[model samples]
Target: MFPIIFVSLGPGEAELITLKGLKALQNADCIFCPETPARDGRLLSRAADIMLQLDIPADHIYRFSLPMSKQRMDALNAYDQVYAAALSLHHAGKRVAIVAEGDTGFYSSIHYIYEKLQAGGTPVEQIAGIPAFIAAGARGGLHIASQEERLTVIPGITTADEIEQLIQSRSTVVIMKLSQCTDEVHRCIRLHPEYDYHYFENVGTPQEKYICDTRQIEALHFPYFSLIIIRHNSF
Candidate 1:
């Protein structure tokens, strides 16, 4: 039975892919990468770019246009579609690697397909990769958490009231899917003046940018790939 591998392409950099993930991509019979629709109608795939950066050429690469939607039904439908296609490829004796950006288990929609494949008793494997928040922390040379330090990850669509409560805790907080919560972000900005905000976008890629200026951070609308790390001033 051919195995379906879920390969995590850490952040956006090819170099950050673990040795195991690199090997998985190189040895796979085919790779399925999630691509986004560009403004020009061309498909843009970060996974494919990383694959090329690693000199891992492929002939049977599949680009599935996955929607970056906040709605659950829209995302589930896309994952189901991809899962069906991947299963078809796997049954054909192909080692299928469905690549996802960032850690597979960390706020990624790819896990939907992974769980679906697992429940169906299909042979599946997950290759871990560096999460975007971790890379952002590393990029700034800032330690996110220390011994006995509490670390909490706030998901994308958390309510503003919930976010306010999370920030009140004496812990390091990582907020992902920043694009979805514009109002919550503005609320957080207005409410929390004591915390330090580290904003990072397109981390690990050439387009990476991070800022500590709260005024600047509040001025711009956050993008889909953006993440905000919040830590108390004392920490």
Candidate 2:
């Protein structure tokens, strides 16, 4: 099997791609750029965008359309298919690079492929990129965690009771995958008005923004997937 590498292109901005990640992409025999089907049926890849910003050639980049469904088996099967295809490329003596967005170890689809590669005994490496949450924290000048306080990252699918319980700990909570649980988030904010709330959208990109007001967040639906950070004012 051919050796493979996972390159992280941080969040939305092209310049966020790390120096190491860029070099890996430059040296790769070919690249698989992960993309998702947009609402308009167009395949969009943030990795390709970042590569362009870094002056990487688009000629060898192939579209990897990862199925973005909540159905567990569907996505898992898709990952397996990609894994098989990657192995085929490796067999032809190609050193492949799969460009990933965001950090490798944090909720990345690359996790599936990485594990499969491990099982198959292929030489693989990961280039870490800044996670969206971390980038958002830096952009908004918000301290993520300090002293004895803890930081929790949860998906929006979390139950309301679970969310309320988490807030009671007075720790910072970062909410993602918010398309499903926006109402619960608003309710949580209303229930615990003491905590600071900031809504971040398209973090690390030119279109990035944050809202300090709960009312504004409730009134608007972000065009892209967004993150909501709730933290106690202790710091």
Candidate 3:
């Protein structure tokens, strides 16, 4: 039986992929990557870009449009389709690698697929990568958490009330996927001005930008990959 490896490509930079991940990609018979809809109606795959940067041949790479909806039924269907494709390849005696952005276990779609594949008795290996929040903190000169302080990572799609409560508890907060709920996040920050906050977009890439003032978050257009870090009394 062939092995399936889940490779994390890091936050955004092509060079940030781990040596282990690179080796896995190099050895794999086929690589599967998630593709997003581009502005021109074409699909764009970050994993493909990483492969190109590493000089991997295009013939070994394949792109799949993974579902990213919040709906339950749509999400289930998407996972099933992707898993079936991977399983088909594995049964063909192919070593497969699924490339994901950021850490495979941290709010990544790869996690769902990994769990499903494992439950079906398929052996899977996970390759770790740098999470976006960590990269954001480093770029903004902010420390996410220390000693006894609690760190909470919340998806921006979470309700405003939950976010308000989390911020009130004074935990170091990291809000991810901010593109969908920027207004709600802005309100949460406005309610808690005592904390120092920073907005980071496309960290470690050429488009990377850091905003120290919470006020600026509302004016700018946030990408789906953007994150916000709120530091409570740690300035």
Candidate achieving the largest TM-score: 1
CA lDDT of every candidate: 0.86, 0.80, 0.82
Lowest lDDT 10-residue stretch of candidate 2? 216-225
Tens-place lDDT per residue, model 3, 1-235, is 8679999989988888899999999999888887767767888877688688888889998877765566767766766777898899999999999888899988886688899889989999999999999988888777678788888998877765677677668677788998888777777767777677789988877788999876787677778879988766633
Clashing pairs in 2: none
Instruction: Tell me the RMSD of model 3 versus the true structure.
Output: 2.1
Query: Candidates sorted by TM-score, descending order?
Result: 1, 2, 3
Error of 1 at 31 (Å): 0.6
**How many pairs of residues collide in each model?**
0, 0, 0
How many collisions between residues are there in candidate 2?
0
> Who is ahead in TM-score, 1 or 3?
1
| Model 2 stretches with alpha carbons more than 4 Å out | 222-224
- Per residue, candidate 2 scores C-alpha lDDT tens digits across 47-152 of 7887877877878787777778777787787777778888888888898888778887787867888888988888888899988888888888987887888788
Shift of residue 127 alpha carbon in model 3, Å: 1.2
State, as a TM-score between 0 and 1, how close model 2 is to the true structure: 0.92
Scored by lDDT, model 1 comes in at 0.86
Q: TM-score each candidate.
A: 0.93, 0.92, 0.90
State residue 80's C-alpha deviation in candidate 3, in Å: 2.7
